[model samples]
Target: MTTDMKQVYAYPDALTEVEMRYCPGCTHGTAHRLVAEVIDELGIKDRTVTLATVGCSVYAYEYFDTDAVQCSHGRAPAVATGIKRVQPDTIVFAYQGDGDLASIGMAEIVHAAARGENFTVIFLNNAVYGMTQGQMAPTTLLGQKTTTSPRGRTAPEAGFPIRVCELLDTLDGPAFLAREALSTPPHVRNAKRAIKRAFETQVAGLGFSLVELLSTCPTWWGMTPLEAIKHVDEQMTKCYPIAVFRDRLAAQEGEQSAESAPGEGE
Candidate 1:
C-alpha cells in the first residue's frame, strides 16, 4: 500500500451514492456536484431542501442527499417559494433546466423574484431541451439547431435566446445573479463560487438569488463529451457572456464601507 498519496477531494456528503444516469459528458452531474458542495460547505445539509423540476434533472431528488421534492415542470420556483415561506429558516434552492425554467416556469420565477422570495435557484442552461429529444429551449442560441429546429434557430421564427441573469438583474428583488460556464476546470471552479454566493445570499436573509450555469448536453449536441464542453467554452458563451449581473450583498458591503470611511481630512 502506498502511503505517500493524499486525498485532496472527496465526494460531497450532500450528494448521494446513486449512479448518475446523464449522458456521458453532460454537465448536469458537474452542476449537481457544485450545488451539493455548496450545501455541504454552508453546513446546511440538514436544513437544505431541493426542489427538482422537470427535464433531464427530473430525477434529481434521488441524487441529492438533502430533503427534496419533485416539482412540476416550470413550477420549481412556486414550490420553493412555498417551502421557504412555511419554514423561513430552512435553506431552500430549486434545481431547474433551461426549458423547465426559462420557458414554462417563466412567470413563476419572475413573480417570485419580484416578490423578493428568500430562497436560491440553481439554473442550468444547456440551450436545448435535452431530455425531450433536444427541442429548442428558451435559452437556445440563435442559429443553434435542435430536433425541433433542424434548420437552426432563426431570429424571425424563434427570436433571440433569453439571457436569464441579465433579465433577472433588471429586477430589484434579487440579492445575487450571475452566470458561469462548466466547460473547463477554471470555469467549473468559478461556477462553484457563484453557487456559493447564491447560497450565502439566502443564508443572510437577502432576497431572491440565482446562479445560471451554462451546461453541456453531449448527446443532444451531437458531439462527444470533449466536443460538447468545447462548444460551451467557445460558441455558447458568445451568446451568453459569463459575469455577475447583480450582487446586492456586495453592493451593500460597498455602501457600508463608504459610510464608514473617514470624511474629508481625518
Candidate 2:
C-alpha cells in the first residue's frame, strides 16, 4: 500500500469472491459487478434478489452476494414478477442473456413488461448464444457467423436481429428502457449508469425496467478481445444503437413541481 496512491475502485461487498466462469474477454462478469455495485450503493444488498434462468449466466447465484434464484430457462421474468408481487419491498432483478431472454423467454418478458411488473432486467446481448457453442441467437447480427450458422445469418433464414429496446418502447407499461454497450471503459461506465437507473426505477415502484448491454464473446466470435470489442462498437452498436428508450420518473417530479408553481402563481 502506497500512502500517496488512492484506490479508485474497490470490490463491492455485494459481489462474492467466487471466481467467474465466463470466458476471457466475456463481459457478463463485468455487467454482474455493476449490478452488485448498484445494490451496495443503494444499501439494498440485504433486500435485493437476483434471478438467473439459463445461458451463460446460469450460475449467477454463485457470484452475487445477495439472495439468488435459479429459474427455468427463459422464466426469470415470471419468477421475478412473483417475488416482487409477494414481497413488494424487495429489489428484484433478472440477469439474462439473449438466448435465454430474447428467444425462449420472449413471451414471458413481453407479457411481464406489458403487465407493468415492478422489477429490473439486466439483459446481455453478445449477438450469439455463447452457452450453446455459438449458435445464432435472437440478437445475432446479419452475416454473423456461428457454429449453427456456419455460413453467416441471412435475412430469409434468421429474419432480422430483434431490437428489444425498440420493441418494448412501443408498450406503455415500462418505467424505463435503455440499451448500452460494454466495449470499452467509457461505454462500460455508461452501461453501469443505465443499470443503476433501472434498479432505481424498480425501487421507486415505477414499473417494469430493463437495460440491454451489448457485450463481447471473444472465444465464440473467434477474435481477440480487442477485435471483439471493436466489432461491438462498429457493428453491434449500429444494429442496437445505445439509447435510453424511456424514462418514467427521473424528471417527472421536478417538472410536476414547476408546473404547479405557475398555477399557484396565477
Candidate 3:
C-alpha cells in the first residue's frame, strides 16, 4: 500500500480496469486476477486468446486486456477448441461458470478432453447459476437452496453435484486437472499455483488442461464478503476437494526419463 514498499507482485497489465462488476465478496475478481497473473508471468498476454462465456461474469473480456472473443452460453470450450486448433501457437483458454460447464457445456468439455485439445480451461463452480438469477446448477449440492429451488436441491430431483476435476481426470486427453479455492489465504496461494500449472501444461504442448475453482457468490448466496469466504472453505470444500486430479505432464516426464540412458535424468 506504500510506494517505498516493494511490491512482491501485482495484477497483470492485461487486466487494467477499475475494480470489477462482480458483487462484493464474489470470488470472480480473485479468479480473474489469478488468470491475469498467469498470463503476465508467462508473458503470453499478446499471444493469449481467451473465450468468455455467458453468465454473470460474461464481461470478463472487458477486464482481461488480451485478445478475447465472446461466446454463447455453455459454448466457450467449443469455440476455444477451434481457435487453438487454427492458431496452435496462441495460448487459448475458456472462462466458464458452473451453469456454463457442469450443466450446458458438459458435452463440449467432454469431447474436447477426449480429443485432447491443447488449451486451458478455468471452470468456476459457485454451486448456483448467478447470471440468470440464482438457479440450482449441476454443481449445486444437495439441500443447497437457490432461487430456482427455494426448498433446497433434493437428491431425488437434482441428483448429486458434478465434480468436474474428478470426471475430467478419468479421460485420456486431460493433461492437467486440479481443483482449488479462493476462500482462504492458503487456498488462494494454492489456487494461483494450480492456475499457473494449467497454463504451463498447455505451453508444454500437453493435451487438455482444466482447473476447477471453488468460488464465492455473496449476492446469490445471501452472505457478506467475510461470511462468503468462510462458507467456501466449510461448505464448498466438501463438494469439491482441493487436489490435483491428474497431471499427464509429470507422467510423461517420468516416462521419458525411464526411456533415457543411464545418468541422463533432467
Candidate 4:
C-alpha cells in the first residue's frame, strides 16, 4: 500500500518571515502577498527593489525580502525613477497608497509617466487615509464620509473622485495602466494578474506601468472585514471601474499582426 500525498500553499520566498502589522480586515497584507508572489513567479526577487511610500505602506520594506527604500510622502515615484535610472538592470517598483500617490505625489507620478520612466507602480487605493485616521483621500468616492468629510463628500464641496486609471490613460508615455479589486476570490485573482502584467511591462523595458488595487481598511471604515470587502465591490467600483486603461504591448502586437496580414500585399 502507498501513502497518499498532499500539496499545500506555502509562503513566497520574496516575502520575509517578519510578522505583518496591518490591522484586522486590512487588505494591505493581501496586496503585499500578491506583489511578493509575482516577484517569486518572475524569479526577480534577487534583482527586485521596492520603494515604500508613506502612510499605510511605510513599513513595506520590513516585509519584502528584496531591497527596499523608504520614501517620503508622495515622493515614491521620483525616488523610483532615480533608482531605475542608476541601476537599469534591477527591477524597481514603488508601493504607494491613495493618500500618498493620488494626493501629495500626483505631480511626481504624472511627470514620471510623462517622461516614460521605466518602472512599476503599485497603487493601493482604499478610499481613506488609513494611517492618518481615515481622512478623505483623492480617490475617495463622492458622498463617502471620512474624518475630513464627515458630512459626506459633496460634488460642489469635494469635487468628484479622481479616477487615476482614466487620468493616466490620457498620457502618452505609460506602457500600461489598470485597476483591480481585492475584495473577493475572483477579484483577488484578477488583482494578481494585473500586478504581474505591471511587472512584465517593466521587465520588457516598457515605459511607466501602474496597477491600482482597490483595497479595504476595515478598522478605518468602521465595518467588519466582510462588510469592507463588500464595500469595495459595491461602492468603490462605481467610481473607479476595474479595467485596463492602456497596454502598449498589446497595441504594438495588433499593429504588427495587421501589417503582416496575408492580403496586405495585394
Candidate 5:
C-alpha cells in the first residue's frame, strides 16, 4: 500500500491515567503518544515489555500501560536483552534519552546493536539533558548553550553531537534502523511509521531495531512548544537527517525472490 493510504487511530486503551509532568513545549508527550499508539496498533499491548531508562523519561513506566520496568542510568538495552531472552515471545522495547543512550549507556547500546538482539529501542534525543538540570548531552548541537555549557558548546571542549543513526548503522547486527522527529504533523506521521516499523521488525523475529527521535525540551531550551518544534526543524534536522539506515530483513526477502526467479527459457 502507498504511504499516504496508511491510517492511524487514537489508542483508547493505551492512554495514560495520570497527568503528564513534562514541561510546556516538551515533545516527550508527543513521543509517548506515538509509542502508545504503536503498541495499540500492533496489538502487542499485553505481550509487550517496556523498559524506562533514567533521565527525563524515567516516568515512562508510569505513563505506558504495558508491563514496564525501570532501569539504571543507560541500562535499558541490557535489561531488554535479558527480558527478551527469557521470554522470547514477548515484545520488548527500551525507551531512553540521548544522555542515557549516547553517554552513560553507550557501551550497552553499542553491544546490543552489535549482537543484533531481538528488541526495539525508542531513542529520544532532546539535545540537552532536561532531567538533570539542563546539562549538555551527547546529542547537544554545536554552539548550543546549556547549564553546563554556559558559553555555548565549544568544539574544542565539548566535541560534536553523536549522530546515533550513523553511529549504529556502522554495526552489522541491526535488522532495521531509522531516525525521526516529533515536531510537525508530517514529522509526527513519519515518526509513527518509524516506530511501528521497528516493532514490526522485532515481531517478525528479526534482529535489533532502533528509531532515534530528535525531540524538543522546551523547559530546558527556553522556548515554547511551538518554538521548540520550529527550532528542531531549523537546527536539529540539519545535524540528524531523518531516514532509514538498514533494512536487512526486507533485503533478505528480496534476495530470496531474486534467487528463485524463473529462467529466461521457462
Candidate 6:
C-alpha cells in the first residue's frame, strides 16, 4: 500500500526558529510572517537587511532570519537610510510601529520619503503603544481610550489621529505607498501582496516604499483575539482605509504600455 501526505504550510526560510514573544492576541507575529514570506518568495534572504525599531516590534531582529540592526526608539528610517546608502546592492528595510514611526520618528520618515530614499518600510499601526503599556499613539483613533487617554481621545486635547499613508501621499518622493489590514484571510493575502510590491519597488531602484499594516494589540485594546480582529475590520478600517496611495512604477509601466499600443489618438 502506498500513502501520500501533503504539506499544506510551513514556516518561511526568511524567519528564524526563534519563538515569538508577542502577546497571544497581537498581530505583530502575523505581520512579521507576511514580511518573511515576501522575502523568501523574492529569494532575497541573503541580501536583505532589516532595521528593527522600538515599540512592540523591538525584538524583530530575533524573528527575521536576515541580518538585522536595532535602532534607537523612533529612528529606524534614519538608520535604514544610512545602511542603504553604504550598501546600495543590499535590500534594506525597516520594521516600525505607529509609536516609533508616526510619533517621534516622524521627521526621519518624512525626510527619507522627501529625499526619495531607496528602501522599504513596513509600518505597523496598532493605534496604541504596546511596549510601554497601552498609551495613546499618534495613530490612535478619535474617542479611543488608552492608558494615556482613559477618558477617550478628544479633539484639541488629544488631537486627531495621524494618517500616515495620506500624509506621505502629499509628498513627491515615495514610489509606492499602501495600507492593508490583517484581520481576515483575504486581508492577510492582500497584505502580503502589498508587502511584495513594496519590496519589488526597492529592487527596481524606485524611491521609498511603505506599506502600512493596520494591526491589532488585543492585550492593550482590552479585547479578546477575536474581538481585536473584528475591531481591525470594522473600526480601524474606518480611520485608515485600505488602498494604494501611490505606485510610480505601475504608472510608468502603464505609460510604456500605452506608448507601445498599435494605435493611439486615432
Q: Report how far residue 223 has shifted in candidate 5, in Å.
A: 1.1
Candidate 2: stretches off by over 4 Å: 256-266
Query: Least lDDT summed over 10 consecutive residues: which range in candidate 6?
Result: 1-10
TM-score of each: 0.95, 0.95, 0.94, 0.93, 0.91, 0.95
lDDT by residue for model 4 (80-119), tens: 8899889988999999999899889999999999888999
Candidate 1: C-alpha RMSD after superposition: 2.5
Worst 10 residues of 4 by lDDT: 1-10
Clashing pairs in 5: 25-225
lDDT of 5 by residue, 1-266 (tens): 69787655544466568777888778888888888888888898999888988988898888988899999999899999999889989999999999999999999999999999999999999998999899999999999999999999989998999998899999999999999888899999999998888998999898899999989998889888889899899999999998989987678778887788777324
Q: Candidate 2 — worst ten consecutive residues by lDDT sum?
A: 257-266
Once superposed on the true structure, which residue ranges of model 5 sit more than 4 Å away at CA?
1-11, 252-266
lDDT of the structure predicted as candidate 3: 0.89
Error in Å for residue 231 of model 4: 0.7
The candidate with the higher TM-score, 1 or 4, is: 1
Q: Tell me the spans in candidate 4 whose CA falls farther than 4 Å from its real position.
A: 1-3, 253-266
Q: Once model 1 is optimally superposed onto the true structure by TM-score, how far is the C-alpha of residue 241 displaced, in angstroms?
A: 0.5
Better of 3 and 5 by TM-score: 3
Q: Where does candidate 5 have its weakest 10-residue lDDT segment? A: 6-15
Put down candidate 3 lDDT per residue, 1-266, tens digits, no spaces: 67789977765687976568988788899999989988998999999988889997799888899898999988888898889878898999999999998888889999998888999999998998897888899998889899988999998887888998888877888889999999989999999999999899999999799998999888888889899889889988987888998887888888888899798756
- Model 5 lDDT, full chain set: 0.90
Question: Residues 1-266, candidate 6, lDDT per residue (tens digit)?
Answer: 23686665789899999998999979899999999999989999999998999887888899999899999988888898898889898999999999999999999999999989999999999999999999999999999999999999998898999999999999999999999999999999999999999999999898899999999999989999999999999999999999999988899888888888767545
lDDT for model 4 comes to 0.91
Instruction: Give candidate 1 misplaced runs (Cα > 4 Å).
Output: 255-266
